[model samples]
Target: MGYWSSVLLVFLGSCSYGVLSTFVKLAYQAGFLPGEVSGSQMFFAMVFMWGVALLFSRRKVRGKQWLTLAGTGLATGLTGILYYQSLQYVPASIAIVLLFQFTWIGVIIESFIERRRPGVEKVAALVLLATGTLLAGGVLAGEFGSLHPVGILFGLLSAVTYALFIIFSGRVGHEISPYTRSAVMLTGSVLITFIVYPPSFLLNGALTEGLLVYALPLALFGGVIPTLFFTLGVPHVGGGLATILSAAELPMAVFMSSVVLHEKVSLLQWLGVVIILVGIAVPELSHKHRTAAVRDRG
Candidate 1:
């Protein structure tokens, strides 16, 4: 796929993730525990992704590639579990801000692994994305006064794992078909998730009790779509640009909370969302302008 196409894939994947928190919150309100919510989502996602891979994917996994891909998926599963756990101790606003630290962390990983400093456009976009996240997540609105240490740690851990996920997704087994890669990696994720959360809901009739409602949407948006899209797109775009585009998640989260959950979003939050869009555009627009100028000179 082309660069722009890959960027779109990552952006859409990020937006799908943004919707996850809302559904999690809904599930919690409906009296399901975090383990139930996360485990069911993983179980359903594993089933769905494997089904698709069996039907449509043609790529074969060579020796040790499965191990590498599955190992990388540990980061994915940990990210979900840790982030969800953090929400139990901290305000959602604070949790989101901490989770978004992945933006810079991702850039740092790219820099370290590639042994190159990030370009000016990426730095600028990171600054804007961070600033906008603060406002959009209501961290600046004084709503997140509690800084629980455990929550902060879990949130930061999630950020690190998420950063690793972005980097590894691009660099490791990227030649594999997106379908096969997604299936294997998510299989690893589901294994780890099930080990930690223990899919007890499968035996206790939680699905019949209404957890299935949240599980299906969570699986599709959080598990399947992002996994497939990231596997397909991150390899092409590289990690740095992909991280910036994934900032689309924050604004979309804010919008979804406002629209779907009837959360009160302030004007500043709206402004932050706009700023985030501008930030996400910064690199793409700068690249286009440079391309145009070079063409003119040519």
Candidate 2:
């Protein structure tokens, strides 16, 4: 696939994720608790992804890949739990912004694990992303009232776990098919969710109804599809580029909130969003330019 095609795939994946938050919020409004909503989503996603995997996969999953997928799934499930928990205490917009701190978390983790410093472009991108996130989130305007400390901590934890997911999955290499890997991960997530919240599936009331109606779609769009796409596409695009493209989720979420939820984003917030996009784009563009220059020189 060409570079632009890969980018388009990533964009579509991000947009899918962007639309997912609204469904989650709707589920919450319908009275589902965080753990219950999260558990149900994982369970359904596993079932769906497994069916898809069976259709597409030709090779069987090996023991090592199984282990990797298990670990990845556990991390992913816990991240979802933490993210949902944050939503209970904070606005979806704020929780998402905090979760997106993963962009920097990924960079820092990659640098430390590789024992190498980040390039100038990456460092600049990180700074811009950070500053822009704060601005967009209105963190500087003393608007932290909407943010709970516990929720903030969980959000950061989600970012860390997500970064680990990307790092470990990347290190696992590309031998395993995306279909098989997604199936394994989804199964692991299902098991972890069941273990953590056994009563969730057993609960009776409006919550279950909400899960069936609203959260199910959220899980399918936000939980299942994005994971599948990223697992497949990131290897082709590289994590750095994927991360940059995934930043689109932030702006897309804001746009969706405005259009669907009738939420108003301040001018500063929109400007911050623009700045963040520039930050993500600059590094990729520079890298592409340098690669072309090197090719020409050769």
TM-score, one value per model: 0.95, 0.91
Whole-model lDDT, model 2:
0.75
Taken over the whole model, the C-alpha lDDT of each candidate is: 0.86, 0.75
Model 2: weakest 10-residue lDDT segment is: 199-208
| True-structure lDDT of candidate 1 | 0.86
lDDT (Cα, tens digit) per residue for candidate 2, span 142-203 = 77875679989988898777767655655553687777787788788778777877844555
RMSD of each: 1.5, 2.2
Q: Which ranges of candidate 2 are over 4 A from the true structure?
A: 1-4, 202-208
- Candidate 1 lDDT tens digits, 1-298: 8878998999999999888878887888899998998888878888898889889977789879989999888888999999888877765545666788898999998999899999999999998998888788777877767577898899899989988888898877867777888888898889899999888999999999999999999999989999899998998888988888888888877787788878788988888889889999999999889989999999
Best lDDT goes to which candidate? 1
